[model samples]
Target: MFDMFKNNPISSIACVLPPALVNAFAKQNFYSPEQVRHVFTNELKTEHNIEYALAMFCSQLDFDALQLAVTYKELRANVAKECFGGWPRFNFDSLLDYSRQSAGAGGGFAGDGGCGDGACGGGGE
Candidate 1:
C-alpha cells in the first residue's frame, strides 16, 4: 500500500490488490468479498486501519473461531512477515477479545472461548 512511507498518504491507506495478486490470492485463499470489505472498514471500529484478514473473519464475523485463529497465527508468523516489523505484539486472542467487546455478540464471530461447540457465546457471557 505504500513505498517506504513516501507514497501518497491518503491513497496509500487503501489496500489495493492488483489483478494478478487478486487472482493469485484467490487460488490459495477462500473468503467472501464481504469479509474483505470489513477488513478495510474495521478501522472505524478499531484504531488500526487494517486487520488480520482471517482473524477479522473469525472474530468479527461468523466463522470457525478455532480454525480461523489458527490460520491467522500462521499467517501472522509466516506469510505476513513484513507486517511483523510494525506490529511487534500480535495476539489473535487479544484481538478476539477486543472485537467481541467492541461489537458485542452481534459482532458476528462464531463465539468466544466460553461458548460450547456450535453455540454462540457472543455478548451473553
Candidate 2:
C-alpha cells in the first residue's frame, strides 16, 4: 500500500485513511506482497491473496494419549527452536508438571482427560 502512494501521495487511499493509523502501520516496513497478504488474511480469515496453505492435521485413528503427548512434545520443541531462537525455559517435562498441578488444583479434563484412559498422570513419558 505504501508503494501505491509513492507515485501520487495526495490521491492515494493511504492518504485518505487516518494519518496516525497509517503512520503506525507504515513503521512495520512491509515491502513484500506476501507480508501484506498474510496480515490481511489473518485479520480477515479468507486468504484471498495467499497462494500457499499451511496446515497440520492429526487424526487419532489408532494413537493413544501417550502417542499424542509425544507428538505435542516434539511439536513444542521444534517451534521453540525454529521460531523462538532456542528452547524455552520450560520443556515437555516442565509442561507436564504444570499441567498436572493445574489438574490437581481443580482442573479436570472433561471428566477424565478426554481419553478413554483416565486423566494422564503428569509428564510425557
Candidate 3:
C-alpha cells in the first residue's frame, strides 16, 4: 500500500487518517491487506467517528482471533454505548417534572403503592 500510495491522492487522505484507521487497513486473520484496506476505507468515508468507535471495539480483539460475539456491528454498538452512555444530550429535567406531577395525583401511587388505610397490605408489617 505504501508503494501504491506514494504519489496518489489517496496518500494525502491516508496521511490525515488516525492510527486506528491506519491499523484497520492491514491484513487480519482471514483477510488480505487489500481487502481490509478497501473495506475500512469505505467505512471510514461513510461513518462518523468510526475510527474512534472501532478502536473501542477492537480492544477486545485477540491475536488468537477467538470468536465471542457474532458480528462487528453488534460489538461496535455495545462498545459505543459503554463509551458514550452518559453523554448528557437529552433534557432530563422534563422527566423530573413528569415524576413530580405524578407525586400527589393517584392515591400515593407515586411511591410504595400504599393501601391508603395505612395497612400497606402486608399483614400490617
Candidate with top lDDT is 1
Candidate 1 lDDT tens digits, 1-125: 12311232111121222122243334223345454445344432432323344443333233343343245554444312332222434443333343333234332222222222222222211
lDDT of each: 0.32, 0.28, 0.30
Clashing pairs in 1: 61-108, 61-109, 105-123
RMSD of each: 15.1, 21.1, 22.6
Query: Estimated TM-score per prediction?
Result: 0.24, 0.19, 0.19
- Give candidate 2's whole-model lDDT: 0.28
Better of 1 and 3 by TM-score: 1
lDDT of 1 at 31: 45
Winner by TM-score: 1
Residue 10's lDDT within candidate 3 is 22
lDDT of 2 by residue, 1-125 (tens): 33332332211211122222223354222223334344434433554312211101111222223233245345434433322234444332332333344335522222211111222222111
Worst 10-residue lDDT window for candidate 3 reads: 116-125
- Residue-level lDDT for 1 in candidate 1: 16
The worst-scoring run of ten residues by lDDT in candidate 1 lies at 9-18
Candidate 3's displacement at residue 83, Å, is 1.9
Instruction: Please say which candidate is ahead in TM-score: 1 or 2.
Output: 1
